[model samples]
Target: MTDALSQIRRIVSARTPEAVWHELAAALKPFGFDRILYGATSNRREGSVGDIQDVVSFTTIARHPGRGREDMSFFIRTPMFRWVMNNSGASSWRWAEEQFAKGLLTPDEVAARDLARKSGLCAGYVISFEEPGSRRAAALSMIAAPDQTQDSIDAMWAEKGDEIIILAQTMHLKIQSMPLKVHRRALSPRQREALEWVAEGKTSQDIAIIMGISPGMVEKHLRLARECLDVDTTAQAVAKAAMFNHLYANPTGEPKR
Candidate 1:
């Protein structure tokens, strides 16, 4: 157990999201776990709790064949997840307290309970780490055989809080590294203007009316922005650009457009 803890700490300390995922898989395998999933959301309103705001994974024991390499679908549809989200606060400590209060379970054990009884996971755990300087919170979940007990879970937290915190911090840092700042090279003056309006939540037609451009032109520029960001959908493109500071308007502004 000490060696596993050391390895997990080293993996997270590497400061690379990819490395963390690889190491997480290896470190968790000893406990009979097969797969792991992670997700984050700065604001619950932009999407919803349990939605994959960001993701990373490994598949040594658990084989999610046909599932895309970076897929994030598990979170959205898992059973009892809604309950977990509604009950669990968006912080690791909050969830931990609730778990301990409810069943002498630590946060990890509570998470494991959901995985086992509700999410088809035999033995599993989930921990939420709220990102610093941002409202965004990241959730890390692992699935294994249904044998981990509350004592074991609590012991892991007691002994390895520092290592787990490192993993959580690394995850948050990677999310930040993909900042949504606007890139001048990626958008023309007109396109930039259009996106700013979109970020403000204006429809293409609305933007066209506001900017005196044809609706077709408005659509064209938005499409281009999506392509530039390599995102399949316009909302995703807008989010990427906005996070990178390229979007024109602040969605989190007052009045909540």
Candidate 2:
């Protein structure tokens, strides 16, 4: 626990999320995992499942040379991602193979597996972090080094799976604490107030009357909030703002909810 905490502190001490990701990847390398892909979304819902573009937030840290290109395609095609979508907890590449052998792999899933194999990513573990009663969830993949065989990777996991899970969990929580670019944009006071009221089920007219502002003014502020959040509707803006902790921000600028 002491060593794990120390590693987590080092990773979190990084000045930026990108730096934190790099530190985390380095920490996992000694465990035979040389590549990593970590992504999270606070907007998970029935409509958003299996749609990469609907992820409200995402981040990836990988040592693979083709990581940038791969990231773009993997989410839509990966069997591991499909598994994470339906289940919560840790799983390994062997689990994916079992699914494949069961004839559960779709065409895209087959393509994703072939791509990973071609890239020398033959063994890895995937961990899903899902908070109770929250739409937010995250997934982490720790891929074995190219030179490592499946047997060696499996042996390592059998020996240190608990430690690896702890490390990945620590990294996930630390990443959540760090500010993401999408979350850094602060809403104007009025914009936040409007969204907060909306969260309480207040309509624009209701909010305007409560705030002693004209209905037109309330609508204008809501529109600006939507634009700022890069969403098309008030509901989406409210959801997006909530993801950034803007709707119920405390005096210390942290989300109360």
Candidate 3:
């Protein structure tokens, strides 16, 4: 109990995703999970968690070239992703086996399952974080050591499931509050400033006045910002930048200078 609280403190104090991930990995290591994958996205819709490119994810597993770790699209094709999208809480990997036995798995899911087994990832646990707004989905997959069986993991869960869930939830909330980095090109300070002013309901000319720049330059900044965020309009730029936490904070989770 004391150790859990201390680990949560370390996780909360972490300023960067790498720092937090290290803290989380260390905290879960003793529980038999040797590797972990954590992913969250705010761009999801019904029955889908959106694209992996837009998700803010961190993994402890070594990402080898051409493996599923490098190509996260592999995860999206798995039945576990479907389960996390539809449910909450922890689930034993055997649930997928049962579904497969009942012929409930899709072809892609079957392929992913078979691939996982070949890769020595047949036993593990997954936790689906609850979505309060329904516009987002987050989950963590913890892969137990190869020597650990599903029955052993289940027994461990029976005793420490709540503790694991609490740790994962704490880490999730911390990660959410931290600055997010998406696959899009980062907006420049000028671009971020322009969008921030626009979010404050300022026009291009107004932003130019506040930023001490010409209106045409302001328009140029806004245009570049839109392009960087891959949005069609300045309004969409603001929303997308804000959605990824790029408008208010930097990668270090500190105020933009």
Candidate 4:
């Protein structure tokens, strides 16, 4: 118990997202689950995780990117994705099976299940978390060991489900409190600073004065920020950056991975 507590403490205090993810995955390894995917969104719509660009996610599943980068947007069309967007609780992979048996699943959902079976991802647990804000949603998916059957995993869950849920919740909250950084799309210090100023309700001229630059230079910074964030306007850039904590990132520039 003391060792578990110590590990949990370390996980929460980890400075970087990579550290936290590695620790979290290590912690779950003994519980027969080694593959985990954590995803959270602050801009969810009725049945979506909102813009994929705005999602905060970490994964342990190896995508074999050397072959080809996986299209993560495909997750949006999966049954589990819809369930997380619509509900707030832990559910078994059995739910998907039952839905399929009852002929209640859509064609796309059935196809998703077939693919999961082919990929050895057929047995797992999904926890759709209840967030404090209406616009927020988070979920964690844990896949059992390849040698484990769905029935065996379910029996284990019955005995240790509460502990599993608590650990996942802790991980989600810890990740939320940490910095959000994306290696694929890191903003420059000037670009992030410009977005921060915009989020603070600063105009072009106001930001220019505050940043010690001309209005045209301020406009250029904001424009570059919008482009970096892949947003159509400064408002969208500010909203997206703030949502991901990019606005609060190190002005010294993101550290190398």
Candidate 5:
């Protein structure tokens, strides 16, 4: 168990978030969870816990065929997601099934269940973790293989629940620390620097002086940053950049001067 945990820690320390997910996926295969879907919403609004627009999520499930479409169209229809929104910590597919049997599921939710079963995601466990003092929540779903049964999964969890929780917590922490690529957009170094200065309440002229660049250049960087983040104004760009861990990134290359 110690060796496995050490390996997980090493993987979590990877330089890129994608690398961390890949390594974490490989590590989880031994525990009978071959498919993984991990997502987090860092900016959930109060009283809008289940609203999709209020949440920004990053996930690995897009790599699976058809899963991306399912997520976009049917996510809100899933009972599991609704349960996680109202509750925290760990839950299993059995809980969702119980809700279904009680006739508590909406029609859309029933359809979502059928879709999941058709897609071979019949049984699994989900762990939801919310950040302290914030509405930010992270959920990791460990999906069993098509051939695996609920009884087998239950026994495995009984034996290794602690290890599974430890792994999930470690991965969740690493994910929150990294910048996620939203809508296939990434921030360039100069843009990130400009946004960081803006977040520090610096004007374009002030940022220009700090980075030894012209005021025009500072404005240009901020403009490009706003475009990349798909925000209309510099303030919004700065806030979004900071939310994604883009601002104040460690010195990887020389800052534009």
Candidate 6:
């Protein structure tokens, strides 16, 4: 078991979110499930209030018929998940709730019940992380069901909960380092300069002048940022970087740095 865990850690270190998602599904072979979805909560600002929503989900299946990634966005918002989040009966869930309730559940626990119901699931497990050093909390939800008895699968999940927790933490670290890896690869000195400014919410033209480059150059850096982060747009890249502390302009801006 220890050897398997070490191997899993190594795989996680070497992969993207997509790869990690599939690897996680494979690692969970002990539990007989037709589908697996790992959904992480969106990172929101402190004292900046709104719905505490989750975004950026990954999914895999085990010999089953269902919707693909596009279909996932709809199911993650179900009432069943909200009910479970509100009352999971798991010790970890209760602890997470207590922590978030006191100033927990960032953005104040988004009403995602509708999303959860759409997925057609019977059981769910949720876990939260502290984003390394910040008080900010991030949550992940995993839901499942299959021909195997619920009692049996629940037992497996309980026994393997610690392993899953370790996986989550390691996965979190990888995400937080993704941008730095990109920063080292293709970003030029001026491009990097523009990127840092961009990370701080500066416009392309603002970044261009700061880096003594053209707005076009700023646009180029934005494109690189998106490619490196494996996201679609500059805004997503920026949000991902800021939330994960993958890359930062001010050393003091991120809690761990």
Count of clashing residue pairs in every prediction: 12, 0, 0, 0, 0, 12
Alpha carbon lDDT at 179, candidate 1 = 29
Tens-digit lDDT track of model 2 for 26-51: 77889888777777777667624323
RMSD of each: 10.3, 5.1, 2.5, 3.4, 3.7, 9.4
Give the per-residue lDDT digits (tens) of candidate 5, residues 1-257: 58777867766777666667777787778888987777666665552343443244534556754353346345556888787777788887788889999999988889999998898878888887867846677677778887888778878888987788777888778867876655435777888888888888888789999999999999898888888777799988877777777777754423246
lDDT for model 1, on a 0 to 1 scale? Answer: 0.54
lDDT of 4: 0.78
* lDDT (CA) per prediction: 0.54, 0.73, 0.84, 0.78, 0.74, 0.51
How would the candidate models be sorted by TM-score, starting from the highest? 3, 4, 5, 2, 6, 1
lDDT of 3 by residue, 153-227 (tens): 999999999999999998999878776766667788999999999999988889888999999999999999988
Clashing residue pairs, backbone N/CA/C < 3 A, model 5? none
Query: Over all chains combined, what TM-score does candidate 5 have?
Result: 0.85
TM per model? 0.48, 0.72, 0.92, 0.87, 0.85, 0.52
lDDT minimum window of 10 residues, candidate 3: 63-72
Q: Which residue pairs collide in model 3, if any?
A: none
Report the lDDT tens digits of candidate 1 across residue range 84-150.
4444322222344364466665454566446545645544455555445344544656554557654
Candidate 4, residues 1-257, lDDT tens digits: the string is 57677778878777777788788888888888978887777877888766776677777786652111133354555677777778888888888888889998889888877887898887888899999898898888888889887898899899988877877887888778666754246778888888888888888889889999999998888888888778898998888777776766654334457
Kindly report which residue stretches of model 4 are placed more than 4 angstroms away from their true locations once superposed: 63-71, 182-184, 201-203, 251-257
Better-scoring candidate (TM-score), 2 or 5: 5
Which runs in model 5 stand beyond 4 Å of their true positions?
Answer: 46-73, 211-213, 251-257
Q: Tell me how many residue pairs clash in candidate 5.
A: 0
Better of 3 and 4 by lDDT: 3
In angstroms, the error of model 2 at 70 is: 6.1
Off by over 4 Å in 3: 64-71, 254-257
User: Which candidate has the top score in TM-score?
Assistant: 3
